[model samples]
Target: MLRRLLVSLVVFLVVGAIGSYGLMRNALATPICYFDSVDEVSVIGQTGHIHIGTLDNVNAWVGTYLIDLDFETAYDVYDGRYEGYCIEDIYSPDNEGGYALYDAEGSSANYEAAAYLFNQYASSVSSNAERAGLQLAIWEAVFDYGSYNLTQGNGNFYVYNGYLSSAITYANTYLNSLNLFNPDTFNASGYGLVSDDNPLSLDPQCYQDYIIANPIPEPSTMILLSSLAIGLFGVFGIRKRLLRG
Candidate 1:
């Protein structure tokens, strides 16, 4: 009986391992493609959370952020959806929404600037004013590129609330301090795009700008690999016992 059980277990694990690897490739590849159904906006001293339905036809929890990343649906979408694009898509050829970047084009500069801005100012966002300011600054980074002034214009974004002007001004201070919008000093391979479904089919500027970081789904991957190792170990122990018996 033990021998039979061991054989069945081995078969099950081998099959599971294959399926898991495929899922991992789809889930981990291309910056983890997702539809991002939830849109929880950030409030004063409080951050919003969102749930995602990944492209693998699996609904996985990505991460929690101050503002949800989406192309169209607006629940807590910092501002209304506008025609926007982030970085260059070097990962997915079909334009599946979660593509990677290399700081190559205007889109690249937009996201690179946003990445730099987020790296600098995202940690100090304690108040809603600071939150609003940081978000406004990110928008400015994506839309206007090198410009720092937060005034509304023909092809630029203004502060969502007139009251949050100082917060934005404060946000711009750090970017000015660094002075590298597309700073090639650090690696941006971990950053990926978060856009609507098939954004490339349109003019590529008919959606809100958003990005999905890489560290979000790491824990689940670790867990999957660990389970496979344990299963293999158990199979060997069972086979040894059966031989002795």
Candidate 2:
């Protein structure tokens, strides 16, 4: 009976180990590939709104903009404004909304508000357990965003368009260098070909963008490996006992 149990345990462990190795290998083998094309464009002439998404999907969150608002000083704006609130954006929050700077003549107040808002919500839903409420929080946050607005001659908006453009260009170049294939395109709802003037929810433009695989490891494989390792170890111990006897 003991011998049979030991043998069974070893067999199970070997099988599980093999399976885990295979899965990890597969993930590594099929690297996500993006097009290896580099389009060098100066950030000087480019002017448009960029957006970021809540979920790792196609739709971008509203109210967020790719402006260089001094977040360090005004970072507390979003925290204080949305403190103790679980609600989300049902509309575009203009708080993070700021116009693109062409000749450097716009208010940074809205941009600052927008940046602070983006950091607030983006950091909030960092975990999978909390991500479910992200959509609601975002919508609620948008209405919260619009509460702040930019008016004429309030301050210099001075959108760092050149910095934004450089970031995008650098991202494209890096992806091209990776030689990765089958890359998924990131498109934000607030500013893109699919943008709606009065979008239902606010999605902001991305300050920077790139693709990354889901961080969480596979649960199934983890369990299997644990079970297999324990079983094999138990089996080896029994075999040693038998030999000693």
Query: Candidate 2, residues 1-245: lDDT per residue as tens digits?
Result: 88688677777766876786556434422221211221111111222232222322223222222222211111121111111111221223233332111100011222223223233344443333233222222322233333311121111111123223332332233223222211122111111111112221234442222111111234334556678777778777887888899
- Off-target runs (Cα >4 Å) in candidate 1 are 1-31, 41-107, 152-155, 160-162, 197-209, 217-245
Candidate 2 weakest ten by summed lDDT: 99-108
Residue 192 C-alpha lDDT in model 2: 12
lDDT of 1 by residue, 55-107 (tens): 11221111113344333212222223221122221112222334322121123
Report the Cα lDDT for candidate 2. 0.29
Model 2 regions lying over 4 Å from their true place: 1-11, 17-48, 51-163, 175-179, 182-215
Question: For each candidate, what is the lDDT?
Answer: 0.45, 0.29
Query: What is the Cα root-mean-square deviation between model 2 and the actual structure?
Result: 18.8
- Which candidate ranks first by lDDT, i.e. highest? 1
Shift of residue 184 alpha carbon in model 2, Å? 14
